[model samples]
Target: MTRRRSLALRLIVYLAIAQMGGMLLLVPITDFLISASGMAPGWEVAPDDWGEHRIYGLVAGSVTRAETGEAILEPSAALGAYLETNPQARYAAFDCSGVVLRGSSRELVDALGGLDRIRATTLKFKIPGDPDPRARGFLRRAPAASGACAIAAYSYRFAWDDLFAVAALFLTPHSAAVVAPAVLCALAIAWIVVRRGLAPLRSAAADVAAIDVNTLHRRIDVEEAPKEIAPFVEAVNDALTRLNAGMAAQRRFTANAAHELRTPIAIMRAHADNPDDAVFRRDMKRDIRRVQTIVEQLLATARFSMRDACADVDMDLGEAVLAMVADYTPLVIESGRRIEFEPPSEPTIVRADRWALECVVANLLDNALRAEPEGGVIEVRALSTAVVEVVDHGAGVPLAERDKIFEPFWRRDNKSNGTGLGLAISKTLAEQMGGSIGVDATSGGGATFRIGLRKSVVAPPIASFGRVEPQRAEGSVGARRGTA
Candidate 1:
């Protein structure tokens, strides 16, 4: 059933404890300095040994200026009465001419260390005018309002306790004892201030807890946040904004996937009653394949989250492309289309997933086959700088459609036989592998899909390790794979 203290409360309590500890140590030091240092005002004011300040005030008050513009000693009735009642108080004033302005005798004033030289005696000294010849007294000299010198002397019984009482005016006896209650009051006020200060943050946390996919548009009000945490609130709001955009995109993707799946199902349903018809059956199979392609592309998109496609992969680009081309050679021939290969002169080392590399090439080739005219030669080239280009000899893609070709399910021709996800999947896979795919107009009226990957470092061939070219076709360049 214990409550945890907040950071602010903890800090306040710690400082208060430190202050109490300091006071605990300081009181003794001050006491020692007062007793042993002979009344130096290091931690306390100067010692009031024998009421020097009181006598000085009394003597200074009685001296006044006359209406005739001359220094005069006109003791007030109260001062005169005090002097009469208290026989122990002796004071004397002298004019600028060394004449006794207010004294019984000049000899007694000189004996008490007269105003000829003005000074204060910190300790008690022997003096006359008191009943005891060796009475302890304090002597002080002051200046009159009329530029005349004056002196005050008073005697009293000696007591160490009285001396300590006079020196201990800075801190009273219960000074340290008062800290506990003061700290408690301060802690209560601090707790209230801390709670009120964190009110906006608590509200923001509640708002954040309520957020979901549907309510992603809700934003934290920055004005309510304290200035110290305003930037943190703004950063959270920015993350929410990003999440909202991603959710919107995901919603669009889901709607499109549903619509795409619905089309093939509807097409298959329309052909259900005519299975004996050859054209309907062919169309049905094609729709089935289209559905399969959509499902597979969706699966491929899901796989993006399953594994790290950006993992380090090192292999030879030329040898990899050569092997991929060999595998797809039968498909090209079956479709009555010819394919050509042009590998790099040397080992084209590159960093890419071998399966993803082959998959991207397969997608590009599939896209190129659909776009290329019958019997058109599709060219696959692997450059030395870790680049692969798939050039198709067909009507080149228009500049306006090139940008949209890579978007998921985007199609220039809605009636085109193939799904539009090939390029999109290729682009996703390429980006995940730290590569990029783009399309440009081929030099001879076709579209060239370019795939660029990070070039991997490869060791140069030694004199004994010369490159051996494979003799497959005229102008076909291939080499042994080498990588660092």
Candidate 2:
């Protein structure tokens, strides 16, 4: 994955780059302005000479002076002599009245096509250099005499300092000292402002993180967020509101369905009990009982799934477990199974809904009984003040299937007699009460379903009713029990 940079840093980098580009562009702009204003080194203009002309007799006077042995030759002769002395002087000329009075070099005069090419305006000519040819020339009209225009042209090369000056305008020795600190300061200020501006967004994220099914009613503070983000916050709150309504409707449907089915199942059970045929009556009653169990499990699952299902009541863990085991003692006996419950001796209290805990214990015990073979001992032990384990000496759950056993309608064998929701409901109830349930292989054999719960620091009030223990019965069924 590509590493991500913060928005603040990215903004700063972009701004710095833009500033640098702008500064660099200034160099060409400055050069253009200088060139346009006739300030550049090779810039030249033509003078309209309508008065005394200096070049009218310059060539004739120069030849006469050379013959007379004069030190100061005429302008055209002086320029010609200078070119002869300096081979690097590529081009120099003196033009008078549409005629070339004197030429510094024949190459330049030929390139200009005699003197007719020289005009009143500046013109550039390409001249041959040692390595390569470059454009060079400056044209300017000298003072006129007697209606004759005198134009003097010279070739010049740009010096290194000229280029350096243009470059230095954008980047100098102090460029870093000025632009570096300024950009850094701008970035620092921008980061601080941007971070501060996003405070409301950070706060809104925290509030969003804290929201769950229980806090669905709480909405993001739209007013506190910036206007740019307010609309998004409002949309999220609207979605949450819709979600909460849908969840409420679903829960109501489930609860109502379960309640509606329970009454008919109970009535059916009553009718089946009174049937004349013993075989038919027994089969119908068993089927009705299974239906009733499913309905009850559905109701329990729906109840615990609700956000407000947990009741703010402290219940004794040992007492609750013992009571559920006692209630199921007769059922275990009828199934030709033995149950052993070891309740904690001390009062172990936990804050949870009493009904939810009872449902969890009852479901576990029922599962243990169903898994046990005929006359097999099912041990229910409460340990560590807040844990309970139900061990059944039957076929242990396969490792691959243990994770899926608590899912609704998931059964190891598809033909098993139960609705396959007992363990699912039990797991849901345990979690709702801030507890967890899992199954492990027993040391000897079979499977052990362990439940861990949160223990309450505050002890519950003592009830006036005395504790009830499990009673042993005759037959192939028996129970070893205790009470807190």
RMSD value for candidate 2: 19.6
Model 1 TM-score relative to the real fold: 0.58
Report lDDT (CA) for all predictions. 0.69, 0.64
Total clashes in model 1, counting residue pairs 3 or more apart in sequence or in different chains: 0
Cα lDDT tens digits for candidate 2, 1-484:
9998776667668877877766665645555556556666674421211110222223223422234443222346553554455335443335444544443345555555654455655444444553444334444554443122433333433433234344555575577566777677877887788889878988998999999988888988998889999998999899989989867755654664565556657766766677776566555655565666776876775665565567747777777777787787777776777787776655678777788778788787877877889877788877645898899988889899998988766666745756567887888888888999999998888999998888888855553223345545543334443322
Regions more than 4 Å wrong, model 1: 1-178, 265-285, 305-309, 400-404, 407-424, 458-484
Off by over 4 Å in 2: 1-274, 279-285, 304-306, 459-484
lDDT of 1 by residue, 1-484 (tens): 8988677767667867766655655664465557456655454333334345444555667777667765566767766765665666566666545566643334456666543444443334555454665345444445535345545455533234443343443255576457667767767777788778788888999989999888999999999888988999999999999988867766666776788889889989878977777789668766776677677766776776466555557887877887888877766765667777777766667888887888799888777877778777788888877799999988888998988988876877767654566788899889888999999999879999999998877662432223444444432323333342
lDDT (C-alpha) at residue 44 in model 2: 40
lDDT of 1: 0.69
Clashes of each: 0, 6
TM-score of each: 0.58, 0.44
